[model samples]
Target: MKKISLILSLIFLSIGLLGCQQSGKEEELNKEISKSTQEITDKPTIIGEIVQIEGERFLVENKTEKLPDGRPDAVWFSTDEMESLKVGLIVSVWTNAIEDSYPQQANAKKIEINEY
Candidate 1:
């Protein structure tokens, strides 16, 4: 009986941890939605000025976008994850749109820099 109780307790603990992780993911999803709705009202201002102009990958501070059409608010980019990035450039990004990675940063799958 004791052994059975121990096993049950461990299972419960694992389930609780998984629950917490799922909640975090939900929060991130909420943020993405809010950003998109806000964009229509707030307007992120994508003026193309976005400087730094590096090798394809670029950084943006006040970037607000939709997650995906017919879903929620803003779409999250996989490339947005990287810290070191500049502005004024083109790049391809891969997405891991799941519950683990929150705020949805980019992966930078491809990059195309401006001519210097």
Candidate 2:
């Protein structure tokens, strides 16, 4: 009958609309996941020697990278394992964020001592 056909059409339309909305949500979620993956993949690692230690913060010096002022590139980082670190030790530091400054500053998310 015509009434049955109308009801069926409405149901199909509703399902189609719901499916479209669901796909939109899935697309948004996929974009967010891709962005997060890119951030983690592109995260930088600073490899240098511990030049100075101040409280919970330490300065890492990379002699190969130089500044316009002709000094070695250095960055100050705050770490939870300062007690385990010492001067003259080469370290690899993974950071979540870095602040722009004369001597860059960052918080170490991970640190590894590299032995020669």
Candidate 3:
């Protein structure tokens, strides 16, 4: 009877240790999932100077950022406030989605022209 009890206790202890390890792995996975979710939900903002304009869309050059081709990172944004925007003006644009292409493109959700 004693031998049987010892065997049962060892089995239970092994299971308990495995459960704790699995719990830790699950916690780590949850943290990673939360981090990625936040990144997906956050809207990206671009701050740069307008370099070109075509109708309601304009190209912005971010001097601080660069593309793999050694050109300054640029984005073309379509906005209804084109009347208030012009080349050489610095602006901040909030966007929901950006297309992956040379001179990335996005529709501006909000635009703020820098006066100073």
Ranking by TM-score: 2, 3, 1
TM-score for each model: 0.35, 0.61, 0.60
Model 3, range 27-110, lDDT digits (tens) per residue?
A: 999988875444323434788899999998999988898877898988999988888888899988877668999789988877
Clashing pairs in 2: none
Mind giving the per-residue lDDT tens digits that candidate 1 earns over 35-63?
54442212222212233434433433223
How much does candidate 3 score in TM-score?
A: 0.60
User: Model 3, clash count?
Assistant: 0
Deviation (Å) of 101 in candidate 3: 0.5
Alpha carbon lDDT of each predicted model: 0.44, 0.85, 0.85
For candidate 1, give the lDDT.
0.44
